[model samples]
Target: MAAPRWDLGPAREPLGLIRALQGFFSVFAFATLGGFQGSVSFHLSCAGSPNISVSAPFAYPFRLNLATFTPSLTALCNRTWARDVHLVGDFSSSAQFFVVVAVFSFLYSLGALLLYLGYLHLYRGAGGKLPLGDFLATAAFSFLWLVASSAWAKALTDVKASVAAPLPYCHPPAVICSRDTTTPMGTLNVSVVFGFLNLILWLGSSWFVFKETNFHTPPAPSTPSTM
Candidate 1:
């Protein structure tokens, strides 16, 4: 009679909860450059217009000023950890959305790594040591936190401005993912990429913890008698 053994885990982080709420959040589909987050294609946009530059699967007819743009965006995914791979700039409106997504993506990516590591650590406990991936991961997190803080501040300001406008309560510049903005969302995409990366990192960490704590271990083999 151990108190009926009815227990629930603590509530998860708000960010994680929000991320889970979004049914279709995935870096793979987004990174592949051939998908849509609702009406907006996840493709990078022309540097300063509402037009798109590159389409998914990376073919020709759908390609544009590669010399100027393509390299910059794809560079973020160099398959190596130490290099600065993200393409920076809020070129076009669509590009701008990618920027937002990119910042978020960056955060999510790191979150994935951390969460995954956390899973290993929890599973093995003392045996599962997370091989000190401190440098790059730490840097990514620090940078993400700084950028996120800045973004939140700016977003708050934007909210104030929007509310002051002869419009609805706490209105955020409608169609913010567009070029027509009094406040330019230039690095907006960059920050967002980082944010997404953080989200992924956090998720992976959480998963690691779950597998470690909740996974059922098989019964141990019985020892032979030493008569």
Candidate 2:
């Protein structure tokens, strides 16, 4: 067989443009969430002692429960006062799920773009199967994006709550502890936005893909003159 002809025309169409956007947003969604590294800070003060700074660092796959923060030894609060302080919850599951979905979406869109650009003939020759398959994949990813984004959003809310709540160790008598600051999660917030954008892109492309499938074909007109 002759080598498949390369065509750039499809790359300019709505379906192709949407696929490109999906791939673009998918990259940002995963990168922002996966590469995140931040910390929550606190202030510790005991009666007659100056305030001490403590920080608990955390990164992607946010298992805050595993993260520990210990205050520096002060004259009033010695090593005996030092203890591992853990944040309240584990949100790794939702974070990982969101990142994984975005990564797979990027890979799929990249492959689909290659097919549209380099193997147009083969895709068209697949007897409606290719387009139907693409439509199904698009629908599936749309649902996945909805689920992953929602779950991650809820998880992020819990993460903020866990960080903002007073540390359990701060409850002792005469020893005062309070949250100082938390590294902003702007990147992760952007990730959530991109995730929803991907969902919209995939859903919008589904109509174009469905048009190519047999399911979307209009029925033949009736032979009215036969009467």
Candidate 3:
């Protein structure tokens, strides 16, 4: 079977438009929600640690889980990049994770939606060369999912420590982290969830789009057929 063309054909303009539109919207959304701010993407809570936890209010001593793991946990916590914070809403953080997860959650959703649409259009439209734009749009969506998922996974933890006493607002009544976060109906939470599913959907869509991309990517110039 002949491979697909990478030229993007006549659909180039439309596909490019899609890519540009998505990029513009993503940037706009992030900017609107303060997602661009580096500091906004983290949350912090230190229940234990003289050497591990950061400067948090209402210090609560760490409770050792497995004595053997104490040193490992401490090492993880003390990692220099563990500057805890949150992107969407202030959530407690035992580690410097989830900030990007929440923010990219929204971004991923956008990517998934676009990639799906792009595939639909690419297949449904008249046969033409798909331009670089086709590949670019699909690529962006895939990347968005990858980023959001990584951040999301990193932030997952079952351990909850009351690292903060006098439970402050948005603290989940425990040391969820020292970040000011969502209240269920809050805007940031909504956006983050949206981004999460968006990423998930995009992952699904991206797989298909990648297939479509490959399906359409032209085979290398055929050597003149031997007589």
Best by TM-score: 2
Model 2 Cα lDDT, one tens digit per residue, 19-131: 88889989999999999999988877776478888888889899999887754433334433455567778999999999999999999999998888888787767777898
Candidate 1, after superposition: displacement of residue 148 in Å? 7.2
Off-target runs (Cα >4 Å) in candidate 3 are 1-21, 32-185, 197-227
TM-score of 1: 0.24
**Candidate 1: clashing residue pairs, number:** 45
Which residue pairs in candidate 2 have backbone atoms (N, alpha carbon, C) closer than 3 angstroms, thus clashing?
A: none
Error of 2 at 29 (Å): 0.3
The local distance difference test score of model 2 is: 0.84
For residues 124-151, could you state the per-residue lDDT of candidate 1 as single tens digits? 3433232224223434444544454355
TM-score of each: 0.24, 0.88, 0.32
Better of 1 and 2 by lDDT: 2
Clashes of each: 45, 0, 32
Q: What's the true lDDT of residue 158 in model 3?
A: 22
Ranking by TM-score: 2, 3, 1
**Model 1 residue 72 lDDT score:** 35
